[model samples]
Target: MDKKFAGKKLLVLGSNVGATDIVQYARDNGAYTIVADYYPADRSPAKRIADEQLLVSTADKDALEAFIRERHIDGILAGISEFNLLIAEELSARIGLPFYFTRKQWDMIEKKSDFRALCEKHGVPCPKTYVTGKEIPEDVMQQIRYPVMIKPVDASSSKGVFKCENEDDLRRYYPESLKESECGEIIVEQFVTGDEFTAHYTIANGKVTLASVDNRYPIAMQEGDPTTIPIARIYPCIYLDAYIEQVDAQMRALCAGIGLQNAILFVQGLYDEKTNTFNVFEAGLRSAGEAPYRFIKRVNGINAMHVLVDHALLGKTDFDSDKEDPYMKGKCCGIVSFVTKGGVVGSIEGLEEATAALPDVIEYECRYPVGSETPCGRTLRQLMIRFVMICDNREKMAEDIAYLNSHITILNDRGEDMVFKMKPERIWGIQ
Candidate 1:
C-alpha cells in the first residue's frame, strides 16, 4: 500500500476531542502523529492513539517549538483550538515552516475588533460593533442601546459572552467580559434576532475550493438564559438555499480581502427571514468544531479530514470542491448533545437502543466512563454525551428525536434519572 504521508512527522496541538479525531485521521494517511496537550496521558484519549504523547501546554510556544525541533517535525496541525492556532502561527513562523495564516493575518481575524473592521472594509455584512478598551467611555456608552451583546475580543466558545438587556446589565457584565480577554478588550455589538448559520469553507492557494453551510442552535438553555451554548447543529441548513449564492459571494470576497489561503474557516452569521439577508457576525481561521469531518465523509463520500491534513501540512489541494456536489441528497442530518447535572454519574442507558432504533444513526459518544464524577455537566463545556442522527427526511428526524427524548436517560449514584433542564425553546427541532 502506498502511504501518502509516509515518513512525514505531523505535530498536532491540543489533545481535546477535536484534536483526537485529527490525530487519528493523520495516522490513517500514514503520518507519524505526535499528540501534545496539557492534560495527562491517562486522561487524554488522543494521546493513547498517537505514536508519541507529550504532556505539555500548547499555549507555551517555546516548549512546543523545542519539542517540534527535537522531533524534527515536518508539519504542524491544529483544529477547534483558538489559543493553539496562535501558538501554531508563532512557532511555524519562528521555525520557517509554511503555515496557512500569517501571524499578521491571524491577528486580524483573531481579535473581534479587527475582524469587524476587516468586514466593514470589504463590504461584508456584519453587526455594528463598538470595541472597548479597559472601560466603556460615557460618550461611547451613550450611543449604545439596550439588548446588546458584550463579548471578549479574543475569546472563543462563549467564554466571556453576555447579553445585556439594559445599561445596568452592561455595567455589571462589562467587567466580566473584560476578564476573559488577555488584552482587557471587549466588543459590544447590537444583538440581532434570527436563525444562526455557520458556513464552512476550504481555501487553497487563495481560492475557496469547498463550501458547506449548517444551522446551529443552543441547547439546554432555559427561558431567560443569557449565555448561548450551542449543543446542536443541522447540516444542509434548511435555509441555505434561500441565500446560498449571496452568502457564497460574500465569503469569497471576505477571503480575497483578508488574503486568506490554504486554510479552513468557519464563518458565523444570522439569517433574517423577514429581510431575506444573511448577516455575518464572526469567523474563525480554523476548522469548525463538531463531527463535520465524519458528516462530510459519510454523506459526500469525501474524506475532508484527509484534505485538511494535506492542505495544512503538505500544502496540497487535491480534493473535491464542487459547490453543487451531491452529498446526502434527499437526507437530513443533525446531532444532539446531552448535558447532565453535576454529580457522580453512575451509567447511561439507551445508547445501543438509539443506534438500533433510530432510522439512520451515524455515531454516538460518551465523555464520562462509568463511575466517573461529572463536573458541572449542566454547563456547555462539560457535555456528558452526544450522538448523531441522520434521516431520509425532516419528518423522520423529528420522529426519531422524539423517540430519543422519551427513551434515553442518564442516572446518578442514587439511581435518580438525570433530567436535562433545557429551556422550552431549545427543545430539539430541525432548523
Candidate 2:
C-alpha cells in the first residue's frame, strides 16, 4: 500500500480530548505521530494513542525547541485551546514546519480586541464594540447601547462575558471582571438579540475549501461560566437562504482581510430575523470543539479529524467529492451534553445500553473519574461528561435524549442526586 504521509512526522500539542482525536487521525493516515503535553503519561490519553509521548511544556520555548530537535518533527497541529495555539505557532516558526497560522495571525485571533479591530477595518458585520478601563471612555461608552455585553479581551470559551443592562450593572461588574481575566483589558459591545449560529470551515493556501453551519442552543451556564455549554446543534440551519449567503460572504471577507491562510475556522454569529441580518461574533482558527465533529461526519461522510491531519501533512484534503451521506439530507443531528449538577459521579446508568440500542450515538465521554469532584464552570475542570448522539429523524432524536435524561443520575456531595435536563429556552427559544 502506498502511504500518503509515510515519511512525515506530525507533532500534536495538548493531549486534551481534541488533541487525542487529531493524533489518532494522523496515525490512521500513516503519519508518525508524537503527542506532547504538560501532563504526566497516565493523565494523557493522546500519549497512549500516539507512536510516542513527550513530556514537554509547549509554553516553554527552550523545552519545546529541544523536543522538536530531538524528534525531527515535520509538522504541527494545535487543539482548540488558546495556550496550545500560541505554542503551536512558536514551534512551527522555530522548527520551520508547516503551520496553519503565523505567529502574528495567531496573536490577532487570540486577542478579542485585535480580532474586533481587524473585522472593523475589513468591513465585516461585527457587533458595535468598545474597550473599557478604570473610567469608561465617554465616546466608547456612549457608542454602546443598553443591554451591552462585557467580556475580557483575551479570554476564550466565553469567560467573563456578561450582559450588562445599564451603567449600574456595568459599574458593579467591571472591576472584578477585569481582575479575574488573564488579560486585564475588557470589551463592551452592543448585545444583539437574535438566534445564534456557528460556521466551520477549513482554509488551504488562503482559500476556503470546505464549510458547514449549525444552529447553537446554549444549555448550562452560571454567572462566571464561559459561554453556556451547547446542548444540541442542528445542521443545515433553518434560516433564509439569503442570510446563509451573507454569513458565508462575511466569513470569506474576514479571512481574506486578516490574511488567514490555512487551518480550520470556527465563526459564531447571530441572526436577527427582524432586520434579516447576521452579526459576526467570534472567529477561532481551529476546529469546533468535539461536539460538532459527529454531526459533520454524519452529514458529509468526511472525518474532519482526518481532514485536519491530511492538511497539516500534505497541504491538501482527501474529501471524496462524489460521495455524500444521505442520512444528512434534510435531517438534523443533535448533541446533548450530560452535565451533572455537582460533585463526583457515583453512577451513570443506561450509557452502554443506550449506545447498543442507538448505534448513531457517536460517543459518551465521562470527563471526570467516579470519585473525582467535578468543578463548577469558570474553573479549568468545568466539563463533567458529554453524551453525543445523532439520528436522521428529529423525533427519534428527542425520544432518545428524553430516555437518556431519565436514566442517567448524578449525585452531589450531600447525597442529593440530580439528572441532566435541557433548559426549555435552549431547545426552543428565549422568546
Top candidate on lDDT is 1
**Model 1 backbone overlap count:** 0
**Pairs in steric clash, model 1:** none
lDDT of 2 by residue, 82-180 (tens): 678777777778777766678677667767778888777766678987664434786766666688888877777555678898888987878756865
| lDDT (C-alpha, whole model) for all candidates | 0.74, 0.68
Worst 10-residue stretch by lDDT in candidate 1?
421-430
Q: Which stretches of candidate 1 lie over 4 Å from their true place?
A: 38-43, 55-60, 130-137, 166-172, 323-328, 357-359, 375-378, 421-431
Tens digits of per-residue lDDT for model 1 on 227-339? 55566676678776775666676667777777875677777888887887777878877776675766666666665555557765678756666532423576767676667
Off by over 4 Å in 2: 121-123, 130-135, 139-144, 157-159, 171-173, 180-184, 220-228, 240-242, 316-327, 376-383, 411-415, 423-431
> What value does the lDDT take at residue 14 in candidate 2?
85
lDDT of 1: 0.74
